[model samples]
Target: MLQNWKKIMLLAIPSLISFATATLTGTVSLIMVGDLGFVVIAVVGVTNIIMYNAFAIFSGIGHTVNYLVAQNYGAGDMKKGIERTYLAFYMCIIFALLIALVGWTMSSELLRWIGGPKSGNLVNVGTEYLEIRFYAMSFGIISFAFHGFLRGIGSTTLSMVIALISNLIMIFLVYALTFGTLGFPNLGLRGTGLAILIGEAIQVAICAYVYFFVLNKRFATRILVRIKWPEFRLLAFESGKLGMQEFSLSLSMFIFTVFVARLGERALAANEIALNVMSFGFMPAFAFGATATILVGQYVGQGKAILGRRAGTDTAILGTIFLILLGTAEFFFAEQIARIYSNDVQVYELAAYLIKISAFLQIFDGLLNFFAGGLRGLGDTTFLLFISLAVSWLLFVPLSYLFIFVLGWGSLGAWLALYTFLAVFGLAVTFRFYRTDWSAVKLREASPH
Candidate 1:
């Protein structure tokens, strides 16, 4: 167990740092925008939901690439791993174009549907933000692909370094562009979107350079010139299932946000603030989840199902410990954390309450993350898709509507619904993990054409 713990930690530490930094960068951007007012905060929050929803489709491809690359690398087939990476890259490009086109064309209509006509400036501001941000979709896809590949090949440290550098760049740009600092004109919320675009572009360039030159030389594999249609089809099919699951999850969250928006701008902004705080605790779980996926996939490829299961178990245990520590701190410091995101007394106080509520859910959240990730590594995406759709749509969404609309529970009610969903999801996925014969699961074997 100690050895397993150490192995997971080697991957988890860097993955945690990378994910945490990325989350913190977004939090800081929102914090800076918060100073503008609740309206701006609400607008940015809504815009982010739309952006992430689009990106979730690409995440399916990223996960598929991660799983296949890890398996191939573990099986001592670097060439096949490189081929899978190329396939993911092509898929990302095509998907990114589609997302950009749709997002730009329908930004206004989409925001209006969510916020209603009474939303006023929120729809306008959010639309502008989305249109400009849509151009950055390809950059985000490229960065995600490279990061997934790096994680698969056990170069998580490199990925961590890239994330840190990119986030630092984003922070600096957000300060300069949003506040008119360093001889720059104040661009406000639009500037925040621009900063993200620039940061993603920079990360892509760096990742491309490293993957094409440095890592290629080290691995003695040519990633740029490899293509396999059958492998690509297999990856696309797997990724499509994963992508649809992610899309459904994101759509449900967007619907939940819409419910909160109906309560008014104050509620929406407060909810966003609370969610950001919750994300801090979630970072460790997400990191460990990614680590479990990579390690489990690799170990299974090497015909060591026992080690794969042990890796996931150790990661979940470690993630739970981290979440408990973070959640405790969050519970104690909820007010301070909330205040960092908003100046309005009402918003901060409500956000604090929500954060405290979220603290109690962290352990279950860790379990869900690790178990779901482990299952994905074992090519169990179909089951995951079914469960996610069932929980998010059938249970969580309906309950949230009933609570907020019928029961008059407001934002608090919405969060209670979320808590119930996470608890159920965590338990269900964990049970599946424990009972499944993961060794029998198999991805399509890569073959040269």
Candidate 2:
């Protein structure tokens, strides 16, 4: 127990720092944007969801990096691990460029496709934000990819320190540029976008210095400047698998947003607020899961199956307990949390209910996250993706629509469906982890071609 506790701390400390810095960025961005009114907040919210889905898909590839590199690092192949890191960085840059183009080209159409008539302001604001934010994509993706590399190498503290420094820069810029406090023009939401770009750029610069000059300098020579055709093909295929898995899981939420829109602008506003609040409260669980992914991957790579299993089990236990306590506090304090975002009676009331449901789901959410990361670390994402698809689409969507539309349960029913689906997913994933073939996976000495 003492050894397990020590290991958990070793892994979790960096994850917690990353989670905290990310949360701070979100909270500060929203609070500043809120000063412009709920409509601006709503616009920012929609933009966030769109960007999250896109960015997460790319960051999903980072997961593969984490799993692969951690295993290699533990197995005494740190140089090979660094080579993979080089591949990940280059791939991220190329993908980020492509995603930015797509976002710029499709910004307005996305709003229209979601079936909203009064979305002119939203489309306009969001498009500008997305375009400016596009420049940040390369930096963001590289930063996230290197983050996985560092975590994989069992350097979570370095990742944590980078996140803290990056977020501090982001927050300072958000204040200086958003409200024109430092003789800068007030760019409003656009300023928020610019701040993000600048912050991520700084992180990438710092990481490059660390990777090339500090940690494993061997990777500098091995960096894939002109992509190796065979290596690129294999890495791309693997990254695509990771990206698609992420898309399948998160697209359900994106689609669910469309459903919320049908409930009117007020409902959409409330849903967005509730989701952001949930992100804030659940940061620790995410941190724990990231820790589990790194630890499990590293141990498994080291040929320590028992240690890997123990890491997963112990971290899952800690994550579950943390969620239970935090959920209770959140459930009892929903109104207080909601008030921090808005004081509007209608928005507050609806958002408060959503928060209440989120609290109930946190336990299930924590479990699913814990096991899912473990499975990913084990290179078992295929099954996890299938499970998520079934639960999110087959179960959650239909049940939510039936409850909200057919049964007239409104937003409350939608919330219930989400919670129930996540719980079911948690159960399914946990069972599969015990009865599956994930334990057999081992890193290939030669890159897959």
Candidate 3:
């Protein structure tokens, strides 16, 4: 058990660091934009929320590459594995371009709707910032392809390296270009967009080079493989299901925020601060979940149902214990955590209170991620989708409406709604995993031409 836990941690840590790096860069970018004044900050913040939610949805589709590749590679079908990688890569590019086009054309209109009729400069500035940012997603999704391939093959180190490279460059470029320093042009908000575009382009070049190099040296697979569009139909369909499921998470957050926003600016701001505090642990739970996905997926592909089952069960145990420790730290240091984000007495006090509440979320969140990860390996996403839709909107949303508006619980009520949601949703996911036999599951592979 100790050795198994060690194995899981070894795989999990690099992914965790990689996630943390990406998030840290985003935080730094937000802070840099904040320096330009509050209006700029607000526009950028709203744009980020929209951008994040969209990316979350589409990236869910891209993860089809990871799921398909892991199973095929584990079953010793390298050709099919490589085939899926390319097909998914092509699919993501098409989707990225489609997203870019739609976002670009509708940028002004979307911002207008979001900001309302009276939103003048806010909508205009956001439209410009958001349009430019959409172009970056093309390269970002391309890198996701490389990441999925590497992760599917159980090599996570290079993904971390690529993440560091892209995000570190983004940090440097966003700083230089935003401030007119280091001979880089100061285009202000536009600079942030250009920086992301350049960083992701660099990411694509390096990721492409590394993927092929690894392919030749490690896997010894043919460098050139062909894909049939017809064969990719099933992959795309299944991936779209996953995309909707992932999108629901962001939708839930937005809905939850709306409910909180009604309580006024203080509640909203405090809620944001509390979320930032919560994120310190969220990334790790996600990392552990991804690790479980890779391991369990691989084992199931290899026809070792019993081993896969045990691995997932043990992973959930180990992940819960670690999160419990992290939650304890959050509980003890809630005040310090809230203070890091804001110093407003009422704001920080409310935020600190929310952080204490969020401490419970760490455990529930870990369970959701871990079990969900295991289920992803089983290609059980359709079932998970139904659960996300049913529990998130039906239970959580209404509960928030009841607690906040009717009971006048304010933000406290909303947090309780979220707390209730996570517990039920997390346990529901856990139950699905335990009750099912996943070993018999394997995805159909496309014939490499």
Error of 3 at 236 (Å): 0.9
Highest TM-score: give the candidate number. Answer: 1
RMSD (Å) per prediction: 1.6, 2.2, 2.8
Writing each residue's lDDT as its tens digit, candidate 3 over 113-228 gives 55554457667677778888878876777787788788888888878988998899999999998888988888898898888889988999998888777566766544565766
The lDDT ranking, best first, is: 1, 2, 3
> Which residue pairs in candidate 2 have backbone atoms (N, alpha carbon, C) closer than 3 angstroms, thus clashing?
none
**Model 3 clash pairs?**
none
**In candidate 2, which residue ranges exceed 4 Å CA deviation?**
217-234, 437-441, 444-449
Native-referenced Cα lDDT, model 3: 0.77
Please report, as a residue range, the 10-residue window in candidate 1 with the lowest summed lDDT: 440-449
Top-scoring candidate (lDDT): 1
**Candidate 1 residues 1-449, lDDT tens each?**
78878888999999999999989998999999888899889988888788778888778888888888888877888887887888888888888788778867898888888888567778767787877777777688878989989989888999999999998999999999999999988998888888888998999999988888888777765646555677877888888998888888888899999999999999899999998889988899899999988998898678776678888898899999999999999999999999989989999999999999999687888888899989877878898999999999999999999999999999899999988988999999999998998657664474554
lDDT score, residue 445, model 2? Answer: 46
User: By summed lDDT, which 10 consecutive residues of candidate 3 come out lowest?
Assistant: 440-449
Question: CA lDDT of 223 in candidate 2?
Answer: 48
Candidate 2 residue-wise lDDT, 114-140, digit = tens = 637777766766777867666777678
